[model samples]
Target: MAMAADKPFTLLDRCPPSFEKTAQGVCKLHTRYDQYDSIQGVGVGGLTSSLPARRDGFTPEQIDLGRYLFFDPLLSVDSTHSCASCHQPDKGLSDGLARSVGVSGEEIPRSAPTLWNTAFLTSFFWDARAKTLEEQMLGPLYDAKEMGNNPVQLLASLNANQQYRSMFKQAYPAASDDITLDQIYTALTAFQTSLISLNSRYDQYAHGYHQALNQREIEGLNIFRSFVARCAECHQPPLFTNQQIAVIGTPEPEGMPLDIGAEKTYNAPKLKGGFKVPTLRNIEKTAPYMHSGRFDNLRDTVEFYTKGRGHAVPEGVEMNLHWHIWEPNLQDHELDLLVDFLKTLTDESFMPPVPKDVPSGLTPITHTVQTTTMINHSNSAPGKGE
Candidate 1:
């Protein structure tokens, strides 16, 4: 049954009523990073440094309102795609696509990134163009190939609905009667900040459960952090990303022209094909990896890194790759082991339930499970445990 509009949205993790708030309106979060006092070291395996501060602590009303907005197609120029259209609850909060296609069905030039641990990220988007989540939203909200909406039209759409007006008013009691763009951004950010994912088998091991991972997975973890592979150097533990720009020399899909990744954003020559390093927290759930979605699976993607550094770089293109990019000459078995360890990072513990029906009266959602073969962690078959 569809939930009543008046009822507050349900949540599985931290919230205002359960935790005390400071005078600044900030509520302290209980994260896995908080489990360890201060023993975590930067870039070290089996130990993680304190996570960057999160943007949590929104009221239940605001969060519930954001939840409704996130799934409502009313935000798009055409009443077809919602925020949930791209960032689905399934598929690890990422659409299962090589390149995202908007309501117009036009190619969006890059893959939809996973929103798993975005609350902890300082930078947003592949090019590291936006500093805040609100800024990040503007790109998709108005981009012709993305949501394709303008602020004027968006507010008009929200105001047209009586339920939305009431919801927004309740969410922001002291604000004006008129709905504003800032409120929309804040609501979205609030809901997204509540998307916490830190209870995986890997997290269990990180929290000091020796039997959580079998010997094979443990070996894989060792190889992952070892200098030989050095995957952990950029894909740091806890969040699994150093969150910096790097010209990794990833290739564009065949027949597609060069993207010039972060070069346009920074206007620098060295960053000709750089992009923000994404967290590998739910690597198995997101397929067709890289900024351009060049490789199809983990094996092909991992093998590309050791394939003579800039081997995948288009012919005649001179590039300055990140210093970490080097030939590791990893064995096939070792590569498989590394993949095994990555699967242990899967955790949908705090995944919010998709609404049955949104206030906009449009169909709530449609998503496809990724076709890529991967470990089914729920089955609890040995190393790939619950």
Candidate 2:
């Protein structure tokens, strides 16, 4: 079970920046303003048809504070990794690695998923362990292989910092103390929920802008939606996800233990290899696909679905072949068209900028380098599973 599941952190109690406080101290959020002002608009046809219903109260101040916290390395035990370190904006909010390297410089078992359109998701993480974004925010921090910061110590560290204290005060004026774990989670969740990605060539086309997509892209769109490829069955448009978990039979890394993805939380044999269906909104930018990051590029990923590269299932494990709708018999040109359509989902405006400096005075982000010896060793050895 998650640590802070018992805490009360509802959207109504913590109002957004746009909210007006009543004389009786009741909070109400205003949704009248054009929230899409900052990002490019999708015009009409409601391209973001799958956008999850917005929560009532998120303040601009809270978002600002969360942004700082997300980029700050102080949240980590060793102060070497920040949320942005693994979810780099330049790399489409995902580290450009098959598997992520945690604070100890050890490889994490699974791929770091992109933060794009997470507000639409009912659950967070590949395993779907976190039900709310607030819960998800604290997950990596507590994970020993990830940030590895104890919740008590983490709160103490933040409370000691005058800058964070002031920011917290401004974000949550109702709070008696300078900072608390709930407030931290709230602020972080607010910022992450604000990350919406709807501006793309496909979006423009969907919104009645006929000329937005070219001839090939249009053909690709047809192929994606057609039964021949059936790409859109799971990767449905608007948000581009069916919001379900399935075992598509992706091959386990050689020598690694079987990763019982959703089963870790659900403990059901039927869900043994099931993983959450990630949004393909900015799919082109977030490369190294699948739960294991087994496929390196979009072409390979498309081919996997078409040709089914997944290994045979182990005893007692069932593969959800219903979700695997890609027709292996698709012509090569049709496959090219499918790839072209997927690329249309790339939206550059969705990328968040890395902060020049963080509150802790530590570097906001750092690149991990593998020595020649390490690379040679990896080449000679097989991978270990989670």
lDDT of 2 by residue, 1-386 (tens): 11212222222234334446555443434432233332221322133343445543467667667788888878888777788777878778888877776665566667888887676678878878878887777668877657778888888778877666767877788888758888888888877766767768887787678799999989988877766676666676666776777777777656555677887678876777788878887888777888768788888777767674344466566655544543467777877888898899898674555666666666676454332322221332111211
After the best TM-score superposition of candidate 1, give how far the Cα of residue 287 lies from its true spot, in angstroms.
1.0
**Residue pairs whose backbone atoms clash in candidate 2:** 16-57, 16-58, 16-59, 17-59, 256-385
- Top candidate (TM-score): 1
Give the Cα lDDT of each candidate. Answer: 0.76, 0.68
Local error of candidate 2 at 293, Å? 0.8
lDDT of 1 by residue, 106-195 (tens): 555788889887878898889888888888888888877577888999998888776777778887889999999999999998878777
In order of appearance, the predictions have TM-scores of 0.89, 0.82
For candidate 1, the per-residue lDDT at 42 reads 58
RMSD of each: 7.8, 7.6
Among these predicted structures, which one has the highest lDDT?
1
